[model samples]
Each structure stands twice: as structure tokens, then as C-alpha cells.
Target chain A: MSQGSTRKTLASIAHGRSGDKGNHANVAILGYSQDAFDWLIGFLSKEKVEDYFKPLGVTQVERYLAPNVRGLNFVLKDVLAGGSSASLRSDSQGKTLAAALLLMPLPPDCPARLFFKG
Target chain B: MDKVRIGNACGFWGDDPQAPAHLATGGNLDFLTLEYLAELTMSILAHQKAKNPQAGYAGDFITVLQSLILSLKAQPRLKMVTNAGGMNPLACAKKAKEVLDQAGIVRRIGYLTGDDLLDRLPDFIRQGIALENLDDGRPLEPFLSRVVSANAYLGSEGIVQLLEQGAEIVITGRVADACLTVGPAAWHFQTPLEDWNTLAGFSVAGHLIECGAQVTGGNFTRWQEVPRYESVGYPIAEISSDGSFLLTKPQGTGGLVNFETVAEQLLYEVGDPSAYLTPDVSADFTSVEIQDIGSDRVQVGKAKGRPKPPLLKVSLAYRDGFMASGTLVAGGGKAREKAECCGQIIREKLRQANALPQEFLVEILGAGDSLPGIYQRNDPPEAVLRLAARDPSKGIIERFTREFAPLVTSGPQGITGYTSGRPQVREVFRYWPTTIPRDLVPFQLGFL
Candidate 1:
């Protein structure tokens, strides 16, 4: 699929998973290809993810890179309210967080050619 | 079997009951590992033990073992390692022996002890071991009375010892879930304790398949890509002496095993890829690599690690309060609005009666209640309204559970789906993660 003039979601270039570790939830966004991985290193940032999930009242967001798998793990701090045992939310664990983040619109800065081609 | 073939039958306590038999027959595995202990499972087991002395360990183990006795007899060399011993390994092992003896399959059922630290907390505290909460840094003084379960996560040493002593089935108390594989891999290859790299590799393999079908596409992001998600195959890690491994499911089984599945599980819920701290070793996930070598087989290697951490992680659960949750589905137009109003009506009624819970949440599940503020939808054809509340007193929570029934008749027009009766008030045990020095607790392997 070509990266068109119309903006695409991050799901266009990458896939991910999110799970909880106590009150913190880590989301690993893996690039579908090497080109997408290179583009994501610059396009997706800790600041960007934090701002996106700010409404969830997370305290902090930290990013760790695993180049072997072309993954960027973003740990959202204090995001799960009280976490699994104590959380009152339907998702006591933040299991759907990755799906929520996947909806984010890809910024225009991401050029059309840099998009992943499967 | 130079490369030990280990298959995990079940991940958590309530996982598939038939998987043990399926794996025992179809996997052709040298060892069948069952992981049952979760962070808060020990607390639940503690309460069960308090009621009945022989009720602490996982009951599913006996039932699953009973069903798999013939399969185990056919494959006599096949061994098993499980933390299903929960709060009581002796009782679990005793039950296992009874089942095996009855089936005429006599084997030395080995169970490890000395991991349960509930009784030792005061002694350690008197000796100045604070046993502080790792997350909040709070000391244990205030919550001592409320503490229900306290267990140190033992490493692979106990299981390795049991295996070395010719035990076919090894049961243990709250060892790190990954140690189910680590112990067998270390014993099979005689891997040194100080050999961090190899241990790390074993730990990586263990963690990948630790959650049973997770590595075989249970939680894969691309759900459609997995051929059969419902009846998906359980994972089998064929680990070599060098700690490298290949991950595959039983042949003709439904599921996919590729680099994505391996990579996803490798970092699932792990904070830092470079430092995944388990009791055996702090595995460096970044150094690991996965390659799909055709036919549903994925080879993983190059996992590095540092020496085992001096302090072992501890999970202590203390009774915080009582909590109850109930759900009701509403249909037709404007269901979301009616559900919201009904929840507010219930809370207002509770407030008027002076029994309102301290922590209350009303979630319109279908209308994006899972992610709350992150994802919001306008309205759906029907939505389930969930009411969850927590309070220090049980009587207060008892009052909250009664309100859900009245809403079905008096509140909204299409309020239904309450056939399960009033929600039971459950004692809430908040997780306290901390660490203790490795030398403080010693491991002992005993035969049943």
C-alpha cells in the first residue's frame, strides 16, 4: 500500500502489544520492516506518546530501544490507575492500550516513500 | 535429547484443563512444565489453606495429572516442573503421588520447600530486614496484621537438585514462573550457576513460552494472521545445551510461530529489553534474535545476561479492602445515556443511605470504557454497564451489591443480563513487590 497524501495511522507502518507491570504498562511498537523502523526512530518519540495518552493521567513515559527486533518499548508510568488487583477499570490491566495507540494518525512529516511496503 | 524439548501445558491456574494431556501426547516433549502462580495467587492460596489444611495448592494439577497418567506412563522419561505447588508443595506433591500410585505409575515426586516466608516475616523484621515495598518504598510495619501471603521467588537451584537426584516430577512453591524451564535446562546440560549467558538464554526461552499459548499466537497483534486462534497449539521450546532454542507448536496444530510472535513475547510486559530481571538471571533481550526457519519453526539465539541479582524478588499481598463489581447490559437507542443515568441513580441512592464506597467506578463497557478517556465512541446499539466499588469495610460493600438488582426492574427500560445474581464481595489483596537477599532463604528438595 502506498503512503498517500491522506494521512495514515501508525498501524500502516508498524504493529504493537501492550501489557501491565504493576501500575505501569509497556507498549512495544515494532516496525513491519527495516525502512519503517528507521522512520519510526525519528517519528515516534516519548514526548509524542506521552502527549497522546496524557488524557489517561499517566505520570511519565520512558522509551527503550531494542534494535534486534526493531521495537521501541514505551513504559507508561502510573497509567493503570491501581493496576490489576486494585484497578476498578474494566481493563484492570491495560491490555487494549496498544490498539488505542495504533489509532494515532501518522504525522505528515513521514514521507510517502518511507512507508513500509509489504 | 541433547536439546531438551519442554512444552508448557497450562499458563495460569484457570487455563485449558485438556492442554496437559494434549501436550503430553502430541508434543513428544521431554518435560511438561505447568506454571500456575501469579503475583497475587499466593494470597488466594493462603486464604484457602486457612480454611482447609490440604487446600492451598492448585487443584487443577491433580486433575490434569490424573488425566495424563497413562500418557506419562507411555513416555516414562518425560518429567514435569510446576510452581502449581502455590502455598503448599507438600500437599500438591502428596496428591500427585496418590494419583500416580493408583494408576500404577510409581515415580519419585519431588517437591521443594522453604520459599514460603509468611511465618518468617517477623523474624526477618526483628533481624532488621525491613521487607519494604519495592514500588512505594513503604516499610512492612503498618500492614503486618493485614498481610495474607508473603513468598520469595526461588531460583532454579531446587528443581535442578531434584532432577539431579532422579526425580521425574518436581513440584515447587512460589519460584519465578520462568524457572520451570530454567531448572530443567540447567539440570539437563549441567549449566553452571555463574554462566549468565546460557542461563539467560534458557530464561528467555522460558519466558517466551511461560504463558502457554502466548508464544503460539494467543495474543498476537495480527489475530487474523494466526490460522486457528481458538484451538491454538501450546508452545514447545527445544532448548540446546548452549541455551539457544527453537520454538514450535505440536505438528498439525493450529497457530503460527514466527519472528513477530517470538519478539512480541520476548518483551511482553517487560520494562527494559536489556535488563529483564528474573530470579535466575537478568536477561538482555536486546541481544536475542529470532528467525523463522520454515514449517512453523522459529529459532531463537544470542541471548546474553548478567549474574543473577543478589536480591530475589518478593510478592507480598496484604488485605487492603473489599471490592465488588456487577455488570448489566442495556439495549435499543440511547442505551449509553440510560446506563449512565442508572449508574448515577444507584450511586446517589447509596450516598443518601450513607453507605457510598470510597472508590467507585461506573464504566459503559461497549462505549469505550476499557481505555476510558483514551478512546471514546458516540454510542452503540447496546452497551454493558459495569459498577465497581471498593471500601475498607465489608458491610459497606455488601450494601453496594444490592443496588444492581433494583436497577433491572426500576431503572432503564432495557436493563438486563443480571442472571448471575448479586456480585460477591471479595477481599482485595494489593500486591507488594519487594526483594530479599538470596542467602536469607535456603532451598530443600524432598520426596513424596
Candidate 2:
């Protein structure tokens, strides 16, 4: 915790979308601004995302940098059971995976908070 | 530079049926594309075909084309392309031709076939072609008897061929969804079939608007920015000869076309951004530049392309097992606890009956357990407890469906919401994605 700093959820700084590829699901988190994108590049690592979605029994989490869209895409493997057809989960395609990731708490001193107002 | 504007109104079979007429009449376009088939849609159509010989295609296209007859007549130059032919292109084309004839419009209806591989599976096997799964390298032998539908994704060459041969309306089966756009763009610009860069650019544009409203702010994350949902206009790609294009919706129509909306769609259902593989060309989406040129208009250009893959991807669906799910509402006090308790009761009863399924899941909808541990929160006033299971045996799935009703009277005090009766057991159509050498499957084109 830093002096005069506040903590917030990742949703405050970024928005995302997710879809399925067979049993795997890919979630793309796009930062609201260039500063937020830079901040996300440092804070949102693959291990952190994997840990966040650990309850989903993700086999592997691979992250790809998309500076073009100012986004980071995380491909969570074996997370959708058997995906669209065979998966029994209500969120079979992992449509809400991005919304779940957005719930991750941001650090107290995260600089991206400047874009948002309380 | 001369440009051809192509608008896609229907993304899939069940998409807004009125959109094709809306886009055709509104956007002064050169071509209109309607994509219908998804991965599992073919299997469904296969089942339909098995019941009736001439009933394997997307029937929605005929209804939509009938509505678009006046619009098509109004814009004489407006051509249309679609893959509404799921397992049967000839039947789809025949129905479409009847619609045009009834409307007193004389237009050539061209169709492309040979993508359906169900009949040719044994031939491929005899030729030493192993139709192994792309995800897991298991050969498609053990599940051969259970296989329903198999179709190879064809490319834009046949589409372009049809367009060049003066086919005003092109209907196809199992062609790459993007090829619906690529075919028209390539034919319009007279681009060589091997011009990977141009072909890739068209492919990217096709991919962007193929889902209709997706590129036009349908599922946008910043949904507030999109105005007028009552009639969100479909997407239009105003493409030029050099492979650059501007994406926009119809004038005065609701929905927005911006960098964010376009970018979001670019990532939709795509695995690797750098290399988006297709039958026509390998598109390098990483190099693609999206610029918001104006309100409801975004310019997308500079998408690099590589040589097309030697293999064509095939979508194979088989009867894996049976699945059934039922949901009940749990409320009053600790709703989460009650929901879990109800789930347990169902599982226990199923176990006692010796009807344990291969896969089972219990989801507490409103309790933040939809993604399980990701959204942990305290119990709310009410929550939906959904119980789902899958098994190789239909008897087990049918047994699982019957367990939900008993929870209302016997299990938790809060359990109620079972008005829909027992959930019906559905046959699980498992998907198998694989690739085959391009030369193996032949492409056929015809007119109706």
C-alpha cells in the first residue's frame, strides 16, 4: 500500500470480451487509454490471470500482446470442458471469463486510477 | 480508386431475418453476404437431411430472400452471396430461385458444392488420409459410425468463378465465411487468385463484418456508446482496389462503427491475432491498422498476408453422448447454501439410482459462482441452481433430468422454480476439427 493511493477493480481501467476455441477460451482485455494499456502490460501477467481463473481448472494460460488494439489476449486452455457442443457448464464458451478477470483487484498505487474519478 | 461496397446482414442462420432487406435497401452496396453455418449447424442440418432428402440447408435464407425480392429489384446492380446451404446447396438454391421467380425477377442463382464430406469419408480413409483431430491427434476411426456431418471449408476461388460467370446470387455450402466477401472483392478488383496481400485484406474485411452487427457495435464492451438498438444497422465494408476499406453501418441507423467495435470483432473467436488462418489466405491481423475515420465509419487497412495453407480445415460432428440440464430457483436466507444443497440432493439421488454421468456440473447463477471462484460474493436473496450432466448412455441423462422436480417438494425449503417440467435429454453433437490436403476434396459449381 502506498500513501494517498486507492485500490480498485480491473474493470475500472479496462474492458474485455471472451469466446471459445474448442475446449479453450480466449479473453481479450482492452485498456481504456494508452496509459491504462501501459499499466496493464506490467500488472496483468499470464501467471496472474491463470491464478485468477485457477478454479476453472485451466491447463495453460498463454498471453499475447496486441498493441494494435491496446489489448492483451489470454488464451486459457481446457477451460470450457468440451466447449460449445459438449460442455455442460452454463458458461460453456467462457463468455463471462473476461468479466470474471475484470474483477481482479488493482494495486493501491496503480497509476491507471488517474483516468477514473470517485 | 474504384471501390465495391459489400454489406453483410445475417451473420448466422438465426440472426435477424429482416437485416438482409434492411441492409440491401439502405446501403447502396455492390454485394450482400449472408453467413448461416456455424460449427455445429452442419450436424443439425445433417440430421434434418437424414429425415428428408431435400431439407439439409438453412431454411431461413429462403424467407429472407423472399423479403429482399423488392429490395433486390430496386437495386439491379446489387449482387448477393451466402453459405446458407449447410449440407445441401442445390436444395437451398432451388428454393431461392422459386422466391425470385414468384417476385417476377429474372436472376441467375449460382451454387457451389462438394464441401460435404460425409459420403466421401470411406473414400478418404481408403486413400490413406487420416482424419485425425486437430486438437488431439486421435484418428476419426472409433467414432466413424457415430459421425453425422463433415464438411471442408472451401475458399473464394469458386465464389469468384461464379461471380465472374454472371451469377447474380451465389449460394454455397461450407465455404469459408470470409470468402463470401473475398469472392466479390477479388472479382470486382480483378485481383489474381495468388495475390496473397489483396486476398488477405479482403479476408480481413470479410471477417470483420461477417458477423453482421458485431463490427457495428452489437456486442460492444462500451455498449453505452452504441445508439439505437431498435434497429442496429448491419456492417458494410466499402473496399477499394488496393485492399483498404472503411467499415460503417447504414446512414441514420442505430449502432456504431468505431476502432473499439472493429477491434473487438477482430479478436472475436480468433485464437492467434498474428496469424488468422483461412482457406483463401493467412491473414496477419497484427499488422492491420484500424482508424476511426468518421462517425460510424472506421478505416481498416494494412493487413499483411501469407501463402494459403496446404490443408483445408474440416468441421466434423459426431453423436458423442446425451446431455440434459434443469435449473431451479433457491431463495430466502442463505440462497447460495440452499442452491448447493439442492445440487447435492440431485447428485445423491442420481448416484443411488446408479445413473452417474460421465460429466456433471452444478452452477449457482446469481451467487457469482458462474465462473466458480472468480466472482465470490455473499449469499443474495435468491439464486438459480442449474444442474447439468452428460453420459454415453441416454438412460443416464434421462434419469438426471428427472431429479430436478423432486427437489421442489423433498429437498431444500427454498427450492421452487421448476415450472418447465423435467428437462428433455438432448443428443450431444461433439465437434471434431481437422485438416485435409486441399487436393483431396473437389470443388463443384452449378446454376439453378
- The lDDT leader among the candidates is 1
| TM agreement with the true structure for every prediction | 0.97, 0.95
Worst 10 residues of 2 chain B by lDDT: B369-378
Runs of candidate 1 with Cα error greater than 4 angstroms are A1-7, A113-118
Tens digit of per-residue lDDT, candidate 1, span B1-448:
4789999989999999998998899999999999998776889999999899998999999999998988988998889999989999999999899899899997888999889899999998999899988767899978888899999999999999999998999999999888999999999999998899999999999999999998888878887789976678999999998899999999988888988888888878889899999888999999998889988899999889998888998888899999999999999879899899989999999999999999999999888877776665558989999999999999999999999999888997999999999999999988888889999999888997
* Error of model 2, residue B420, in angstroms: 2.8
TM-score of 1: 0.97
In the range B324-399, model 2's lDDT, one tens digit per residue, is 8889999887999999898888788878888889899998999886777766655788999998899999999988
Candidate topping TM-score: 1
**Candidate 2 off by > 4 Å:** A1-6, A113-118
The DockQ scores of all candidates, in the order shown, are 0.54, 0.51
**Candidate 1, A56: how far from true, in Å?**
2.5
User: Which residue pairs show backbone clashes in model 1?
Assistant: none
